[model samples]
Target: MAGAVIVHHHARYKTYPGEVTGFVFFACLIASVGGCIFGYDIGLTAGLTSTESFLILFFPDIYRQQKEQVIKNQYCKFDSQELSLFGSSLFLSAAAASLFASPMARSFGRKWTLFSAATAYILGAFLGGVSTTFPVLLTGRILLGVGVGLCIHASPLYISEMAPAQHRGMLNILFQFMITVGILSASLTNYWTGKFIGGWGWRVGLAFAAVPGSVIALGSLAIPDTPASLLLRGESEAARLTLQQIRGIGIDEVKQEFDDLVAAAEESKAVTKPWRELLFGGKYKPQLTFALAIPFFQQLTGINVIMFYAPVLFKTMGFRQDASIVSSVITGLVNVFSTFVATMTADKVGRRALFLQGGTQMIISQILVGTFIGLQFGLSGTGAISEQYAMCIVLFVCVYVAGFAWSWGPMGWLIPSEVYPLAVRSQAQSITVAVNMVFTAFIGQIFLTLLCHLRFGLFYFFGAWVLLMTLFIAVLLPETKCVPLEEVAHVWRKHWFWREFMVDTSADARGAEMRKRIALEMS
Candidate 1:
């Protein structure tokens, strides 16, 4: 509570009024389907590309190469522009779509924006399932990427707005938790489909994405819009009612919470062009920096290096295709379980602690994997390491994935969603989603090439990044645990570094008056 301004309102309340309730839980569950779909796409695409049917149909050259085993370097075997385009194109389109997600969410509401995202994802899945040509498949990938953009932008925001302050971190993490669930589901789907369904298994795997898409689409219709979003839309009475409903309290019971929401919404009204203010407003420098940097650093953790291409990496490491796909399932399981651990501890241990601990684990895992690969393959980077060695590498990769599942993976979305004021919340989140995808696209495109050329050095590069981001968190990020969204500004303004940039004359005056009033009451 250092640098906090504590104001007592009433005998019944301590600071703010909110309790965990079923309505909010239901809303979070539905919104979390957005993460599931995104994860399904990531997990399915990696294994689908490695499938015999998918390769023979869309990438015959890669299929021939897989059969030949003549490429000397296993790492370079699947290094084809066509395959890279298929893997990376979705991310590029997602980045593009994220730029527009904020405006769409602002105009139509978070629920409908998510609805549209699910619809787009379903269409993309259908197109991919029936594709007769590479262009058609590529088109489908881009379409689904667009769906991911909108969902990534809206879902976390919706959850953060609806969740009570006490449980916000735990609740917001459902988005990441669902993502891990989807990855696991996709991995199991890929394993079973490839084993039993024969040549068309990849199609079934791709089509199954529609199942989660349908969940989000139907679920979006049932959930109420967030009170903050309703307030921003000038639906005051509706906002009040929704707040009461979600808080599971009577109208009079929600009055203090309603007033706080209204005050935050009114503060946002003065900024007519949030985007312009976000980029140029000196006061928003910390928020703007955080929006761009957190996601950027999250991607640099190279969690996607595994998430996007686990089966491929395993194949290079010497596992047979079937075994490689199954190995991905192991990692997926670790990711889900680790993220569950995070949901339990994030509110208690705090964000910075997890960031530092997880980053350290990731660094150690990355360096160990890199050193092993270097010794096993020598400078040739061609031979498959022993079966035992390959399994060891998989274990290390799981360590890295586990570290990410709990920390950067969820916090990347949670911090950005909770940090910004309503005025620039959407814009800042768009920046976060877009930056993340852009880097993801870049990684997807160049990873094989880097693996081929850098050999054992690829892991080291990511390990270095983990080190830097860890230092960044240790030095710069303030603990935001259990703080109300509207009260987050005080935390920033009182920080040793961010305080200098958070200057607001009117806000300072209000804060001073509240402090003085509280002091007098205490006396």
Candidate 2:
């Protein structure tokens, strides 16, 4: 069967020829620009909302009242509801846009979908940068949300399809790393702009999103559509050529891969079902469950809460405005660096292990953070928190970010891209991304309000979820370390106990069986 042949090729072509490798790297890098935009949108608001200059220009009444409170040595306050709306608007629009991402990708193809998304980002950035009213700015954010939805839905799918099985995890995870880079870039931009430009800092910070959006729009032209998409469209010869050019292997090797892809494509067509059947029917029940569960658990980790409000969280812990913004930058740095760790190790350590290890650590970090904040509130009330205790909270928050970066941050996108069959990959990915955005919006919308009331208890709420996530990953997620995409369907069919704990050997057996089945069909 082609699956067996693919496994043999996996062993033989441990590294792609230089040109193929370069093309794959370039393609993934270009697609990853969407990730940078996603990060920037998420990170920009953290600083923008915290900037007094921004507040004075947009929310003068709250800014003036806060200033008076500051003058009286009382804690300054902003409208929590307004801030929540400001942060959650993008996710709201993103969730709505995600509903259409699958159809767009399926109808127009991944490359064009990304190009359109980049265009949306450019328009959104322009609107945001020049907004004279809050509604205009919110509308701009809603536009960016459309772009974010398309990009998040398409980028990882494109990368996963293009990348070789052995390197797919790392290459796809690169999207998350780029997101971290974007966050870090936004954080630095906010710091410099806030320090110098004051009132106009957020506008400049937001406008910078257009730079990467432009890069993606232009750079996408250099890459071809995925062979899988081509095969789906019955362009077998074109798919063959693409596999040849991107793989840079010998004729026999290229033919072998082409055959495997065609076999998978044929199988997909044979079993093609409507979206209702694909999602709810027994044939794809496991895949659908996995697709939905992973993204749901990913958001439950409370990572977005921190990304959306890190500076404000720091301020609540007693740091000055500038210091809190600086602290958020540090968190961005940790996020970027730790995502790099995930990129390097995702293939090496396997997805399931990282999920388990990272979830455990996140649970601990959240608990500790909750404890420190609780002690500060209980012991000191409105008095100054001890510097040591404040530092502890910051450290634990970094730990929590590191845990999320190395696990859910990357795997949440990567796993769905791999697990589903190519036929429904786009649709499944759209559903999963929508799930992600829904939870992100829910958390982002209420986090500030929660902080107003729950205060340190918010950490406890997140901690409880992390514990559940740890159990979920340990008990459910099958290891997909080096399993070829064509054969991943078999991974879900194994017994639940084996899927949880003994996936490596089971994947091998499943791959062999898959190969035999394809061989029989071909004969």
Candidate 3:
């Protein structure tokens, strides 16, 4: 029995020390296939609603209306508002569903929670594809949102806990990369199916998500659950084996980590408090603040506007409606491709550089876009969307989204996971992710309002928000690269840079120094 060796499996991981585990990355990609569904479902909705081409292909009768009657009456019009409600329901359901994920992972464990999410995904996809009425679609979206909420919340926790310190950023950044790939895929898939698949094809588009859901389901069987999860359940040996598999270093390297986790858990008196403990109680306050704020700033940047309406934004420039969506696909391609840059650059360039560069670029891109939208040359005066001035809007948006994709998209999740102590990773991650979903829900729900009424105001507002977030992040976000996630708290809890002042006061001093440094450079 002592000589009997147990074969261990890792589900999906990003980094282990300096080495890239090909098998690990491959499995992770497969498990991450859920993200593809997440991306495809949300991104495909825009094409389903706004792309006139989708209408012509699916319901030619609706598109080819009698000029004299239906044109004048507007009865049973293509309900853009209804579409918004359906989409908003999905987001709201997701935000609400996220509340359930931590407890699920805590109670049922990560493996089963993911399996449950997969079940929800399949059911949602089925309902969406077969819906005979608008209400049915809304219901399906809500279901899909539940699956999405669970995946978004748990997947990163899985990768972060599993990836080795050396390669943690590369591995965890998969969430951002997959999301971009999901958006790109949905836009392209919608364009292709709406154009080529023809009648009822849009239904097929919704149903396609089931494919990834199934893949994640199967892939889930391939990887072991987190060591932390097993330990939380009092399976110490299983936890140690899992830690060994994930870190890929001999047990010696992570033996301390495992012990630290065990020690931390024991020292806390196993305080299994309610979620409200995290929200208002002193024990979890710093992490709670971070959890709430990371997602807030991420959404405040108006990234979803670009994600959902990039093509429409492009349409305002000179691209034909169809061409605009195609251009949107190109932007998504940039996102996916650039996310690879994160894998390469995240540990190398570090979170701070990427964020600073990305934030500065986002501000510039937004201002340029606002400038173009404000010019009113093509949008209001209507010489053409392609007027030399208006085309700049398209160019600027592309520039802005590329910046966001490479930076906040990944770092937002990365920082939240790392910035908190491991004792509260799941709970803190849940709140941050829930906050993110809420922001996404609010902004996503209001696209029609922003585009319809205020138009240019949305751009300036988001631009300003990004500028402010830049200040916040430059001040508060500690450099986490090469530091153990468990040790990350020390960066904020102790101010090595300004030892004379309290860490809080030192953080303020650092923020001011950062601002002055940026100002001088800008000047």
List lDDT for all candidates, in order.
Answer: 0.86, 0.79, 0.69
Model 2 lDDT tens row, 302-323: 8987887778777766788788
RMSD vs true structure, all candidates: 3.5, 4.4, 9.3
CA deviation > 4 Å runs, candidate 2: 1-20, 68-79, 270-273, 379-381, 497-523
TM-score-based ranking, best first? 1, 2, 3
- Candidate 1 on 1-523: residue-level lDDT in tens? 1122333221111245557798899999899889998899889988887887788888888888778867777667678767877888888898999999999888778999999999999999999999989889988988999899999999999999999887899999999999999999999998989876458878888888899999999999999889998888899999998988888878766765676677777767767888998998676899999999998999899998798798888888788888898899999999999999889998888888888889999999999999988989876876768977887898999998999988998888889999898879999999999999999888888898899888889899999999999999999998887778877877787778998888685744554465445435444
lDDT of 3: 0.69
**Clashing residue pairs found in predicted model 2:** none
Model 3: per-residue Cα lDDT over 390-417, one tens digit each: 4566567778878997788889888887
Report lDDT (Cα) of residue 365, candidate 1: 97
Off by over 4 Å in 3: 1-23, 52-80, 316-318, 378-383, 387-390, 496-523
**Alpha carbon deviation, residue 333, candidate 3 (Å):** 1.0
Q: Whose lDDT is higher: candidate 1's or candidate 2's?
A: 1
